[model samples]
Target chain A: AQTVTQSQPEMSVQEAETVTLSCTYDTSENNYYLFWYKQPPSRQMILVIRQEAYKQQNATENRFSVNFQKAAKSFSLKISDSQLGDTAMYFCAFMTHTGANSKLTFGKGITLSVRP
Target chain B: EPEVTQTPSHQVTQMGQEVILRCVPISNHLYFYWYRQILGQKVEFLVSFYNNEISEKSEIFDDQFSVERPDGSNFTLKIRSTKLEDSAMYFCASRGTSGGETQYFGPGTRLLVL
Candidate 1:
């Protein structure tokens, strides 16, 4: 089974600053996908970014990017120019490349606070 | 951009009662999924559906839980007997492709079992 872990329970960042949330996973599969999801106070889970395990270039979307070190089994999310709206619970997820049953394995999550 | 939408933003039901959460995934998406998050916990995968059948399910998805895509666009999750432990926000999601594609999620339906 694949497992994702987010060691940081809570993180705080001043507006306009940058914050990085740490995440790691344990899996035997060589090919997979990694994702970052944000759940705001509204309780809506939204996709932030994604990275294909085979792609070493990393994925960036506006202020969000990931540092995916496949060999180390680490995938971290970095939020640049953080704003108050960025405050939310960030989760790391993993999806195997095996079959159509691609269920996501998510980390416990890290609560981020972007104070303005 | 098309997105998944879930109905009944919030539901309050008595224990042992049956509850159904509905979702309308992206029009062209072929795969549907259900996920839940208890208060201050991780988002747990419940079940995934494709071709009108269950493709995958997690341990949390017991016999009491079932999913159905009754029509062309609506995907539903039914909890036969709601329990206090079932009090959580349920989210419906869908992906356009099959090989590790990104799944778009709905705003979620909060289920309160009392």
Candidate 2:
């Protein structure tokens, strides 16, 4: 079984500032995928970014990016130029690369509040 | 861009009643999944379906829980008998075979079992 841990339960960032949410995982598999999903008050789980274990380069998406340390089993999400719209519950998830089952094991999530 | 969609964004059901959450995956997606999140809990996988059958399931997906991709376009998760503990937000996700491993998600259905 895979376990994802987001040590911080809540974080606050001033608008236009940056925030990094930390996440760590325990897995024996070498090949897999890491993801950050954002769930706003609307309850929709939106994919923010993803990182493939094989890719040495970090994954970035506009204002969202990931610092994926494969050896440390750490995948943290960084939101640059944070906006009030970015305030949401963020989840760190893991998926196996071997199969089509592709179920995401998610962390408890961190509530991010972007102060206006 | 095409997106996965789920119906009855919220549901309120009595304990012991059966509830079926519906999802319409992206038209060309090949894999579907069901997940649950209770209040402030983490999202947990329930089951994964492909080729019209279940490909994988978690321990939480016991006998009371079942999934079906009936009629080719709709994927549904049926809870035979609901318990108070079953109240949670259920999310439906779909993955395309061509994509680089990102699963698209629906808005989710909040099931309140009272």
lDDT of each: 0.92, 0.92
Q: Which ten residues in a row have the lowest lDDT in candidate 2 chain A?
A: A96-105
- Point out where model 1 deviates above 4 Å: B98-100
Candidate 1, B1-114: lDDT as tens digits: 898999999999999999999999999988889999998889999999999999989899999999998899899999999999999999999988645389899999999999
- Chain A only, candidate 2, TM-score: 0.97
Query: How many pairs in model 2 have backbone atoms within 3 A of each other, for residues 3 or more apart or on separate chains, i.e. clashes?
Result: 0
Q: Name the Cα RMSD for model 1.
A: 1.2
Write down the lDDT that model 1 would get: 0.92
Q: Residue A99 in model 1: shift from native, Å?
A: 3.8
Please count the clashing residue pairs in each candidate, in the order shown. Answer: 0, 0
DockQ of 2: 0.80
**Chain B: TM-scores of all predictions:** 0.97, 0.98
Name the runs in model 2 displaced over 4 angstroms.
none
Residue pairs in clash, model 2: none
